[model samples]
Target chain A: MKKLLLSGMLAAALFFAGCDGTSDPALPPSSDFTVTFKALYDGQTLEKFKSYDYDTYKVNFSRFNTFLSDITLLKGNEEIKISDIEWVDFTPDSAFGNLTVSVPVKFKNVPDGDYTGIRIGYGVKPELNAKRPNNFQSTHPLSRENEYWLGWGSYIFNKVEGKADLDNSGAFGTSLVYHCGSDAVYRTYTFNTPIQVEQGAAATVEFDLKKLFTINGSWFDMKIPANQFTSNDVGNVIVATILMDNFDAATTVIQ
Target chain B: MKKNNAGWTFKISTFSAVLLIFLMLDACKKDDPPVEDRDDDLVAIPYNPKSYTIPKPEIFPEVPVPPDNPVTVDGIQLGRRLFYDPILSADSTQSCATCHLSSGSFTDNKDVSTGIDGIAGRRSSMSLLNVAYVSRPLFWDGRSPSLEDQALRPVEDPIEMHNTWANVLDKLKTHASYPAYFRQAFGITSRKQITKELAAKAIAQFERILISSGNSKFDRYLAGDPDALDDEELDGKLMFFDEGGLLGLPDAQCFHCHGGITNTGFSFFNNGLDSVASLNDFKDKGRGEVTGNINDNGRFATPTLRNVALSAPYMHDGRFNTLEDVVEHYSKNGKGVSNEDPLIRQLGFPIPGTNPVKYSGLTEYQKKAIVKFLHTLTDIDFVNNPDINNPF
Candidate 1:
C-alpha cells in the first residue's frame, strides 16, 4: 500500500509538472459569454397576476416555465454547445407584486469571436427525455417530480398556467392551463441573429407569452373550453402543436 | 544505546519546517484528505463513525447532504439523546420531543406549541418527517435555510425551548456522557471544543435520517400490488393523482401542491386560507414578514403529508382538527384572496348550484374518497421506528 501510494503521488506530481506554466501552450483569449432570458408579455416586461388584453378578451398568467437544452452558438457550421438541459421559471415569485423575477443564466469560457446566429433545442431533448426523474440526482433540473407527467411518460417541457377572462367583466375566472410535453412536440429552432462574443459581452433571449397563443397575427380562438392540452385528444394535440410552432416567433435575441 | 537527539522540540521544528515548505510550494498540487486546521489539543478517541445514507426507494430522489456534515450512526445516536434530554430547555421541563412526539408523527397534535414558560407560540409545531428534502429557506415563513440552522432557532426562540446556547453548551461540556459521545461522533479532542454549530450538525444528522419506510398502502398499490387498496381507496388514488381517464372522475387537484413521492412539492403557496382585501390585510403575513414583500404576505411552505393521518390539526396555524376539515377547506376553493395561487380557486369540480360565484367544488363522496386516499399515505413503521425514537 505504501509503494502504491508513493507511485500515485509521484505520477500526479510529474503529470502536473508537465503542464506547468512554463510548458503552457498558446491559445486564443477566451471570455465568458453570458446568455440571459427575459420574460415579456406582448412587448413589455411581464407582470405576473396582471390582466393583459388578448385581442378582445383578457388573460393573466401566473406561471410560465420551459426547459432548454443543446443551446449552441452557430458560426457558419462550427457549432459550440453552450448549455445542456436547463429549467427557467419566469413566474414572478408570489412575494413581489412589483419585483421582476427575471434572473440571467451565465456560461463560462468562450473564445472571442463573431457568430451569425444561435440554435436552441426546446425542452429536454430526446436522449434526456427518455429517462425519468429518479434517473438523475435530486439537484438536477430534470429531477423535479412535479414537472414530470406519468401519463405522458415525458417531462412537461413547458407549463403556462393562468386564467382567461371569458368575458370583459374583469373576472379572470376561466382557467387557462397549457402543459405542453411529450417527445413528439419537442422543437429545435435556429435564430439567424447577429452575436459577438468578447470580454464581458452579454446577450439576452426574450420570450413574449402572448405571442405563443397568437399564431400568425390571430388570437387563440376560444372555441373550446378551458384546460387546453389536458389529454391526448387530437384537438389537444393540434393546440399543443400550434403553441410549439409559434415558439420561434415569440422568441427574440437581443445582443 | 543513545537517544539519537530526536527530542520533542526537534520533532516540532521538523513539522513546522515541512508545513512552511509545503505552503511555499504553491505550484505543487496535493489532494485534500486530512481535513484542514485540526486542533492538536483535543484528545483522540475511536471516531470510526459508521457513515449512514438515508434509505429511500429508487423512485424517490435522494436528499442532498451538506458536504460538511455527513450523517453517521454515532452522530444520530447522540442527536437522539440530545433531542430527548431536557438539558436543552431553560426549566429542564421540556425537550425537542416535548412538542415533536413520535406518536404524533413528530408533531404535538396541538393548535399552538407552548414553551418552557407556558406561553403558546403563534404557529403550530411542524412535522419533521422528510424535512431534509425541503427547499431553501426552511420553516413556514421560509425564515431559516438548512436543518442545522432550523435546529438552532427553537433553543433561542422565546416561545419554544427558550434557552440560551451559552447555557446549553456549558451543560454539554460538563455533562456526564455528552463529551465522550461528541468525541465518538465528531472526534472532538476536548469538551471545550463543543459549540452550538457542532450540536446543530449532530441534530440535523438525526433529523435527516427520519425518512419514511415507504411501505404505505399507496406505495404498495403503485408498486403493482393489486390487493393493496380497497375500491374506494383505488378511486381516491385515481382522483388524487388525476389518472382517471374514460371513467371521468373529477380532478380533486390535491396533487398540485401536495404531489411527488413524499406528498409535497416543497414550495410556498397562498392556499387562500383567508379572505383578505389586500395582501397586507393578512394577520400572519407569513413569508412576507421574512421577505418584506407584500405580495408574499399569506404564502406558506407546503408540509409533507407522509403521515398525514398521524399529523392532525393541519396547516401552519392548526386551523383544522381532522383530515375531513382539511379536505373541506380545499373543496371550498379557499377564501378568494387575489394573491392566492391562480390554481387554488380552480378545484376542477363541477358545480350544481352556485352558492359561491368564484368556482365550483367537489361532491360529498369525492371528498370522502380523497380523505380515504390520504389515509393510505400513513406509514405505521415510521412512527414505530426504534432508530428514530428518543434514546433517553
Candidate 2:
C-alpha cells in the first residue's frame, strides 16, 4: 500500500511539472498588425523578338534570392538571429518586370519601445546556420544541391530574365543573374522606418523593387562577359558593391 | 535475565551479517558495464610497429576528418581490405588499387582510367595526395563534395566497377571473410548487413589513411633545417614568393591561382583550352553542367602542382606530356579567346621587328625557375613509405 501511494504521488508531480513547462510564458494580450516583404527587379523589356527553344544555351540564371528571414521588435541593438524566424518559400515568375513578395509577421515578447529599421541579407548568415549532418538521408535543398558543397550554389537566389541587344538587330536576348553571395555576388539592406509596436502591438515594412533598379543608373548592363565572375572582375565588383551598399533600404513603395 | 539478553544480541548480529551480503551483491550489479560501453574485442591485430608505422604530420590536423567518420584503426583496416578486394567490381577483376596504385601517386599512368568490360573513361585520374585539404569538391566538374561521396562513384559507375548496390551487398554477404570483418568493424552482426552507406564510410576511412605531404626538402627547410635545399632551389623559391621580382612578370601571375602554402586554390577557370575553334562541340561541358550557369562553361578546377614533377600527363585534358610542354602552354598565354579568363595576360616577348604573339610575358628563364621551385613541393617520405601500400 505504501509503495503504491509513493508511486502515485511521484507520477502526479511529474504531470503537473510537464504541464507548467508547456504553458507559454512569452505570449501576451493579442493585438493585430501586418508586415509585408517585396521583391524588386529591373523594368527593362525586349519587344519584337520571336521566342525560340530554350535548350540551346547552357548557362541560365535567375535573380538573387537574398533576405532569408526578417524579425521585428528585437531588443535594443539586438542582432536578428536566423533561428528566430521561419522562412517562406519563394518561387520564380518573370512575366512581370518585378516580383513583389509580402509575408505577414507576428511579434512576441515586445517591451514598450520605438522600433526602427529591418535588417536583411542575401542568405542566412554563416554564424547562425544549422550544421548539416554529413549524411545522404537528410534532404534539405542546400544539401541536395552538390554545387553548394563546392562553396557555391547551382541556382541564384533570384533571377532577372530579358532579351539583350547583342547583335544590334534588337533581337538576340540574354538573361542577367544578380544573386550575390560568396564568390558570386552579395546583397544586404537596412530599412529607414522607425516603427513602434507598444507592449502588445505590431508594425509593417513594405518593400518596392522598381526604385532599387534605378538607384544607380539603369545602364549598368546585366549581361556579364563569359566566365568572369571573380572578385577582381570590374563589372562584377561594380554590381556587387552597389547592391551590397544600397539596394534594400532604397525601395519606393507603390501601394 | 542476562542469558535472555545475550540471545537477543546474537539474533541482531545475524541480521546485520545478512544485510551486509545483500549490499555487496547490489554494488556488484550496479558496477557491471553496459553492453555498449564494454571494450570491443574486434580490434585489428596490430602489425609490427615497425612494419606499420603511422607517419605523423609536423602540422596537427594533418588529415581532415568528416566530423562524422573519425579515424579508427578498425575502420581503416576494414577500408584497406575493401580497397584492395576486387569483390567491389561486378567481375571481380578491378580493385580501387588497380587504378589508384600506391606507387603512382594514387593515379594510374593511363591517360584516362579504364573500367570493367574494357571501357575507357573520359578524363585522366587525379592524384589523391592532400585531397583532405582540398577546399572544394572533387573531380574536374566539382561534383562530389565530401570524400565519402567521392569514394562511392567509381564503384557503381557503369564504366568503372560496373556493379549495382544490391549485387555488391549480396557479394559481401556471400563472402566468407568480408561478413566477419564488417561485423567486427561496424558491430553489425548479420551477414546481409552490407549497405551502400557503410561501403562509402569504410572506403573513405581508407582514403583518409592515404594522406601524405611530408619529408620534402622544402618541408625540411620550413622545419628550420637551413641546409636542406641547394642554392639554385633557394633562388627559385625567392622568385616564386617575392611579390616584386616574380609577381612582376605578367605570366608570373601564377600566384593568383597557385598562391599560399598549399600552392593551389581549388577554383575552376576556362584557361583558354576551350577557346579552340571547335569549342562549341566540346564534349565535357565543365562547370556549366554542374551550375547550369552559362558563365561557368569550359571551366575546370585547378590541379595542385605539389608533385607535378612526378605525376605526369598534366591538366584536365592531359594534353601536355612534359613539364616543359605545360610551361610552354602557359608561356603562349594558353590559346586565348572570348571565353578565356581575363587573368591570362600576354606572355611572349616584344620583338625587334614584329609583335611576338601577345602572351603571358613569361621570359624563358623565369618559367624554368618557377618549374624548378615546383620540384621542392614533393614529399619523399610519402612516395617511399611502405606502410601506405595495400597490404592485402
Candidate 2 predicts chain B with a TM-score of 0.78
The candidates score, on chain A by TM-score, as follows 0.85, 0.51
Cα lDDT of model 1 by residue, B352-390, tens digit: 454223345677787898899999999898889998998
Instruction: Tell me how far the alpha carbon of residue A150 in candidate 1 is from the true structure, in angstroms, after superposition.
Output: 3.1
Q: Which predicted model would earn the best DockQ?
A: 1
RMSD of each: 9.8, 13.0
Candidate 2 Cα outliers beyond 4 Å, as residue runs: A1-255, B1-63, B164-167, B220-242, B245-251, B255-260, B263-267, B276-279, B288-296, B334-339, B347-360
Model 2 whole-model lDDT (C-alpha atoms): 0.54
